[model samples]
Target: MSAIASSTRVLVIGGGPAGATASTLLARNGFDVTLIEKEIFPRYHIGETLLVSVQPIINLLGAREKADAMQFQKKAGVLWQWGGEEWTFDWTKLNCDFTSSFHVKRERFDEMLLRHAQSQGVKVHEGVSISEIHFKGDRPVSADWHEEGSGEAGRIEFDYLIDTSGRAGIMANKYLKSRRFLKAFQNVAVWAYWKGGKRPETGFEGPLTLVSVPDGWIWYIPIEEDVHSVGLVCHSEAFKESKTKESVEELYQRNLAASPLIADLLKPADKVSAMYVERDYSYSSDRLAGPGYFLSGDAGCFIDPLLSSGVHLAMHSGTMAAACLASVMRGEVSEERATRFYHKCYRAHFVRWAVMVSTFYDVNNKKETAFWRAQTLSKEDLQGAEWTDLKPAFSTLMSGLIDMRDAQDSDLLSQTKSRLDTVLQQIRDNHPAPNDRFYRNGEEKFDWGRRPENAIDGLYCTYEPKLGLVDTGPTERAFAAVESSPAAE
Candidate 1:
């Protein structure tokens, strides 16, 4: 391992995808990383669908082959039936190299990532909980921990902390007290697993099927050839009103009955799991990073599941947090700069999704329904907001492009427009004779040669010599290669 100061130790809370990704990358970069989880392996989890972007992070961890070996259902894109409109988002239609993701059993998938972190030299302790975090003024210095069963207690001191504590955010909720729930997305989700649901006949083999109902929407995800995960999302008020009259199972069944598409798909299927309900799942923290800690994954923020972006945000934020800390430890960037970059970049990603999701809710044809109207973003909601107009942001997000520009830029909107123009020019330059059918029918394939861009604040992520941020200047790009075993043994 490279000679990182022996005193510098990193603690990662929660062994889920975010914690595992951050811990694995930091350990591979020669940092002393210890990860603690409140639960053991193969625990049940939701948000099983993934985006194409996750494949690159998996490659950076050198776990592509291992992920492939899991044999999760490959997800090509999503099929949407909104109100009376029918459309699809096929990944292959985009100008990107990676064109597919997966529909995983999250229990198995999360365990694989956690085990991968251990193999990469991350000290992991499962069935352990962080009871308290000891801080020196504004910076966290140590934490009090207790094992689940035996009740053994101990204190662990660390130089830096990465909080991937999913939803049970120790720092954000306990210390920082900065989490803020979005009223527009105050919704409830009830889901169950089924066997033998019919696959979509119109889209790719494993596309996520989304159908909008009068009150909310439904998601049909294929987990295995015969097993599927089905869920319903509705406004919280509607859910509460319905609960006053019927059981949760009855409410779910009534909503499912309202969707003709879902009813037909599950006509011959058997419900195989008990109903699971999650309330008000959309939230964001006023802060994502602080004096000596960074909040990653659900610890920092969580958006609605409309786009299946939960895992994508978790893994992406975890990687970004690890890179920020790695750069700080290597003396490649100041702690302040790294913290600012992480907070801005991660929050921008979250906000973009939030805006897009709210806009998507507005597009549902059931505007006449109280449930749908309550979820829609009104003009007053967008007044003076960072993203006032949702059209360009929606297009940019749908294109799957990463914008690393500083969120505080005075001309951010103009810069974003220019960036989108540049992307289109690159696409045209690469494909001089682009297929018209690709635009009209979403059937053609092309490459976008999408590469990471330097943030306006002079930092960008690189994966060649190591996985971390480096100065945009040429002098600091020559990163030293630390000797270590491949992330996947």
Candidate 2:
């Protein structure tokens, strides 16, 4: 073997949840893993609300105890505001392992994950940026990078390269040249942090609140130390046309004021940070792996933030990438086969998420404006397509369920599913008739239309965090063409 290939060295770019997770899992599996991050730790990031789906992933990483120690606000469930009414549901309804997930401060949460990776024997260096990844033949040989503030340059070789680069898509943009943005959720966000913001009733950390308006929706997430992270989401049209001559900050404040509930919550708080702008909320990379490299999380694709799926996707993708790469390193899986698996699972989750995002917008009944109008995925909106199963069916995926079941957790998952189904049936028996205003098909109308997309009669929830391998519900429900039917696994 060449000197570079002699060591099972892995270098992960970006220290976000995905990168930290991938490196940690890789190192735990006995691979020599290193992580490169551009920024120092404890940096600010959005996506503070976590779904119940991340419980096992955290437990798998041995951070369940660590997370429990951190004392983040406990989220009993989600509290959503739609059509002038509010309802709350607990994770017990889904048989989640934890009584509650967390409402985290991303800066602290990410740092914890990175530090946990460091604890697992993964080499980590921050304040260093990768200038370029040099390739030999089709495989990456080395990466050229330097310290953030210094001119001193350095180069390092690796046996495999993993990109958990988040939305930057360092490898996807620099090497593969394959990223396509989805117009359906093509949107931007205006947000800021506020100290002394309102909290949910004292017993729980969340009921992470989502309030939808005519232009778009607003998120009210309680983070650390009695602070709340608030944001507004809008498509490009609403961002530009709705704002007109207003600056981004004004737009943010204006939109915040426009919503009565959010306005009431923020009225007593003080803005702790400048209003921020984030554009292009949705996109997908065409490929996940090439030659000696792999992509995970936002490196591969980004879905809308409505579901708070960003962190889960990142960490899940990273862990999955680590597993796939580890399989090849152990000679347990061929790279050809592994790459195919990565691509399939990565894209599957992305497509499923995209469909979910579309349905979030589809639930808007108040306005027929361009902004809200574009969120629906009707046959005309899909351009002559037929998708049967976009309707929400269960709450399992809200926590970011993967399609595949892990062998180790098979028994536990079975028990969880059985209990979850029991609760689901109880709800089904009491579920009121479908609301006529939103009922297009024979589908049962849910609050926010949030349910399982392809809920198995009792078995269809996605299990693993990495592979989007969802059960197709019997064999007949799988979709083949996306432009036509996007409702399959």
Candidate 3:
């Protein structure tokens, strides 16, 4: 890589984690970056839990200290009560450097990242919405904007665009029209906050507890020692059918009452917030990037939240987009190669997660139920194939061991296999019948990285000195020191 031109203009939409992460990294690399958000800072949002994979990206963004200072509840792993079995997926048992994550209040967490982006010299505008994206041929060249309640509006011209506008899917929905909802994951989520919920006595401390019900599932997250966030997920059709009989509040309560574990945990708790309902269905775009634009975060794809992958994917995509754009602007790689890398790597990660989540649903004890059967993978679903085809990738993703650098064919498989073998050996040396899903899944060899479909134009993500795409073999250093500018300061 070479020094990026200080005159390179990059426009980022949405000030959520994805936008913030991309803006900060692009600014750090000396690009003239501007970010616009439709909402004000500290706005209320959902998806509070995070995965350990986020730690590396946070470090790359230089926001580790700020995140740790928030004192969010530390999550070591997850506890699951599914398939008539109870097990804990402990991160400490995995062969990874970082062994923990956090459960955060999205308002505070998102605000911190956005403010950090501004501090890094990214010109940020709050309450500014992008009304329309202007395109010359197939490339987006500018955007029409307006400030909420301020009567201020203008158009921003940029050499590149990063759409992190979340579920709004400004590019995928309004412009490209490529968003497709996954029918198998059509779900509705109802959640609310509680005060003084009883903490579980078992599993890892500050763990996320997921309990399966006859129809759906419940998530118990410890946002604070006393403040907890509880949510229920049910099939969209089931929710629609029940809504005719009762309000969302009544339906949520009914489900809670039916689940003895969650009901018992909240027995002494009081509802501290209004009920919130969201269509939790999963969706993806047919394409993630084009001529001069890239779609990041929910703008690209959103998978089931069963694994708490929302923030991780957002930050991951943001980092990938920044690296791709920087690589192109610095003349280190062609625009086509960079964009293709971004699309393939980001989409593969999303599909891997989608497959993993759908498979988990199929294996649940309630697979016979209509709610579960609809989502379950059947032999006739896709040429009589089984979900275990990608079990190795699923296990790696579930353990939070995958990263951007591992996006393409490289040393990822060898590394994952060595680590997984060690973990499996320890399991066999100790417990003869290890019931932990992590251990069970670890026994399989990691071959996803070896698959030919993962590589893009024979390029892969690398970060020897800084993040950028690199050729397969026998080449000069692809990335070098990036020149500093006012933005880098």
Ranking by lDDT: 3, 1, 2
Q: What is the lDDT of residue 386 in candidate 3?
A: 23
Candidates 1 and 2 compared: the better one by TM-score is 1
Instruction: Indicate whether candidate 1 or candidate 2 has the larger lDDT.
Output: 1
Taking the candidates one at a time, how many backbone clashes does each contain? 1, 10, 3
Query: What is the per-residue lDDT of model 2 for residues 308-367, given as tens digits with 9 covering 90 to 100?
Result: 888777866776677678667777556776676566556656655665566545556447
C-alpha lDDT score of every prediction, in listed order: 0.74, 0.66, 0.74
lDDT by residue (1-489, candidate 3, tens digit) is 111122339999999989999999989888899888999899999999899777777887889899889998898877777656665667655555677888999999999999999899998888888999989999999888888777677777889999999999999999999887776788899999999889876657788888888768889999988999999999998898988999999888887887777899999999999999999888888889999999999989998888789998998789889888888998988899888777766766676566557655655634666577777432222221121222222233344443222221334334334544454444345434422343343343332122222235555554325656554433322211111111110
Full ranking by TM-score: 1, 3, 2
Off by over 4 Å in 1: 1-8, 378-453, 473-489
Candidate 1, 389-431: lDDT as tens digits: 1112112223333211211132433343354344334444543
